[model samples]
Target: MSQVLSVNVGAGADKPYAKVRLTGIDKRPADGPVAVRAPGPKRGVSGVAGDFIGDERHHGGDRQAVYAFQREDLDRWQGELGRDLPNGCFGENLTTVGIDLEQVLVGERWTVGDPADGEALELEVTDPRIPCRTFSGFLAERGWVKRFTADARPGTYLSVVRPGQVRAGDEVRRTFVPDHDVTIGLLFRATTTQRELLPRLLVARDYLDAETRSLVERRETFTLDDA
Candidate 1:
């Protein structure tokens, strides 16, 4: 029964992020309430469906994003870094209330909207965000992004399953969609060190994207035993 405490968009109004500076702004998930939606015609990522809130240039990577987190992570980080900068400095899109960051796995579903609006939106949790130089710059720590990324405990990326509008203070409820199915987690595992799990993950092929699907297919075709 998690609710969207806040739905934040962009880095900041005054300083909307560009490719380069998008890295500097500490885009923390808001702890209030906000509205969300599939960006409209003017907002489409270079003009396409299912392309909202991310860099259009990089379709399959870390763009169209959302985040769910526990307040405890913020509290812990605040003690460590809040003294010098704003709290929750990572600039996440959605700051979730009562959602456990660790528990929001890939394939999870979140229903979010105001009941009166009759516009509930379901978002499927995708992959864990990989840390980048921007994250390091914001925290002023050399590898805070890696620290969060290594554990794969960072909040999740969401793909819009059912597109609609979300407003600040709108209620968001997340339902675990069942981990028994194949998921983005398995994809990440297959791509990385967990090569042994790749075959098992392939059984869940429908979940794979064009980019990842191609990579996995190529890998399977190769005879790794000799190489």
Candidate 2:
């Protein structure tokens, strides 16, 4: 029952957000159907073509090819923030509806659009996006990162599994869900200030993003016997 409410991409350029400066966060809805392809792990770049990124070191790559935010969640924030939130305002490439981020598992798969219409655009949930200083600045929100982290709804990053065309209103169907308790909210907690949860990420070893997996495995100074 999940569906894409909008598809957005931005022209990358250096821009100012609050006191923090960054680029490629301002996205507008796509004019029409846009090709959705894997940005590839080769070097991680922006997901949508024509969207520029100034932070090559952190933003894009194969593992984080796409970013998605729930329209429902946005609506909630809009009410709380007392501001209207438009699609793509959060820098998400896909604004989705009906997908529960709190329950989303890493390595889950979603098929966007109908295959019969030659639109089997595929995406795999990779990890939850960590809010950055730039994000806080963009929202002009005071302590936004902490607020976002506390909310435990950082949205989700994805990789293109089968690249194709995706457009607004396309149906997003959950094609696969990993059998793990590593939901997006849990993963976000583990990767953020909640370092204690890092060990729990090991449970979804196959699905954990490389960075998270490394953090979990690399931090284990004690051997299994020591535990």
Candidate 3:
């Protein structure tokens, strides 16, 4: 069954590997339920209570309130890297199982936990998690950014549609799926290795985060200018 294998949160700490001297990328599994909600308009505010965001300019906000990574993908990476990567190793708030995150549509909505309990968390998939220098430094793997982008399973970033609480082992149910074909994988490729596919991402413009929307718009302008 599709469920949250673990809910993770990180405390802000100084790390030499981080571009910002301080980073919250070393997340650890939480012991109990964690509150989930939309972050403030400002950057670097995490949606999950007690969670920390390191980079104000590039991380967090309402559009990137939560991040999730699949256990299947983690296992695959573990095999390739020959190391033990536990839940939250990738700085994901939720470590999930039984969901193909890469194939999830950009606007797909998920109800996490039991709705009958009146505390189910509603999350909308907004964009793919792009690999950055922070992530590369965290892993200490050579050519990590290029390798991750090439692999194209960039995980998923989500916005909290309804504030609630989430815990490990909670069920995750897909309540809605957008009609567009802009999956997380497609969006990642479009913004990275496959610039030619950027035009196709316009079909799901309503679901894209601000950064992605701006990228598409800039690309469109560039195309028109060259024409």
RMSD of each: 5.3, 2.2, 1.5
Residue 161 CA displacement from its true place in model 2, Å: 0.8
Please give, for residues 1-227, the per-residue lDDT of candidate 3 as tens digits. Answer: 99999999999999888879689999999998999999977889999999999899889998789999999999999999999999999999999999999999998999999968666789999878989999999999999999999999989989999999999999999999888899999999999999989988988998886777888988888989999
Can you list the residue pairs that collide in candidate 2?
12-52, 40-62, 44-60, 44-61
Report lDDT (CA) for all predictions. Answer: 0.52, 0.82, 0.92
* Residue 151 alpha-carbon offset, candidate 2, angstroms: 0.7
> What's each prediction's TM-score?
0.67, 0.91, 0.95
Candidate ranking under TM-score, highest first, comes to: 3, 2, 1
Please write out the lDDT profile of model 2 over residues 56-167, one tens digit for every residue: 7787888788899999999999999999999999989899998887778888898899957555888898888888887887888899989988998889988888888888
Task: Show the colliding residue pairs in model 3.
Answer: none
Better of 2 and 3 by TM-score: 3
**True-vs-predicted CA distance for residue 64, candidate 2, Å:** 1.0
Q: What is the number of residue pairs that collide in model 3?
A: 0
Model 3 vs truth, CA RMSD = 1.5
